[model samples]
Target: MKYTARRTWPEKSKSWEYLGESESLEEFALAFATDKALEVDTEFVVIEKAGAESEIEFFKVTRTSPYGLVTAAPRVESEGSSTDNATTKDEQSSNDGGDDNYGGVEAIAGAWRGVISNILMFVKAGGAAFLFFLAAIFLAKWLFNAW
Candidate 1:
């Protein structure tokens, strides 16, 4: 299944039609917001080609805990096509620099997540350390005075 991607606004129904299924307006809006927040523009069109299965599958993986959505186009091999050609194309495309923008954005997002995680970890650790130090100091002072 070869699909030509085009940019269009969401209809008044407040839904995005993906693979003939209607997603709720709120979900679509959240998806868009998450994409924008992650520095992804709405200009890219992902063409879902026919692959291993008979039908084209479009998947949007939205992380519930952390706000992020990863949209992937299913890879489909044409009937009677050689596996060698498919493998070669995939390898070539992976090495191609043309799609670097998407990868770059993803990398930036990943970096942001890593930074946030590290900060949170440090904050927790520091808080614990500080509390322990304070407790030890107070206990030593009390023991000294009592003695």
Candidate 2:
């Protein structure tokens, strides 16, 4: 997939900056992990095979994170083919920028919700038990007074 836009990194965070649009959540993750922020140039000397002209191809290494080599330009998107599907796909993928950090957020939110729900339930149960105790004490006092 090709990334064609720019995103800012969190201020002083461990996350890498995402640039451009990605095809999918997986694609975004791959790009972010492998993107190199600088250009690389290599020089080599070689003899032509039989009398063939020597050909040189340029490659740009964007980033190299845990995933692998994330490349650009060489896989450039085709031209003159913009449509709703393409635009919508871009929107969907870009909207999923949250996918990378889903685990942490989801775990924290799940834990928080569970804790809050349990606390509420405990409080309700405790309140009911206290009310019952008070009622029993009042009943005992009333019976003793009657006696």
Candidate 3:
């Protein structure tokens, strides 16, 4: 997952700055944990093809965010098609911009969502198979009790 984060002032979009993109959100979290800023918002995105026959490919992410914003864009195929180019965030930032050192992803905040999202995706992808697995476990439990 990719994270595009900008630090925000406490008063809601009162003043903001784009810190740039990280291949992982941990980079952003490090900043989040340490930064005195009371608020920050993040976006998540996924890229996929419409179908095997369809020439069109699309990137989508739910707009739903308990924080601020969420987004998705096609994986970087070419600079032309890549919506999340590394330099784009720098270009957009109002602050004098460059990569900041927050000592890797270990120092990040809001990681619980990342973990939850991973589990959610697993369950979503395994919808049918997961149900079957649960049913098998229930059957085994019943048989053991009967015996």
Among all candidates shown, the one with the greatest TM-score? 2
Which is the better candidate, 2 or 3, if ranked by lDDT? 2
Instruction: Write down the TM-score for model 1.
Output: 0.30
- Stretches of model 2 off by over 4 angstroms after superposition: 1-102
- Top of the candidates by lDDT: 1
- lDDT head-to-head 1 vs 3, winner: 1
Consecutive 10-residue window with the lowest summed lDDT within model 2: 41-50
Q: How far is candidate 3 from the true structure (C-alpha RMSD, Å)?
A: 21.3
* All-Cα superposition RMSD per candidate: 17.0, 16.8, 21.3
lDDT of each: 0.48, 0.45, 0.41
**15-71 in candidate 3: lDDT tens per residue?**
233344445454443433344333333222222222443222122222223322233
Better of 1 and 3 by TM-score: 1
TM-score for candidate 3: 0.19
* lDDT score of residue 88 within candidate 1: 64
lDDT of 1 by residue, 45-103 (tens): 33333464433323343554455544545445576565876576458658764242555
Kindly report which residue stretches of model 3 are placed more than 4 angstroms away from their true locations once superposed.
Answer: 1-3, 6-10, 37-147
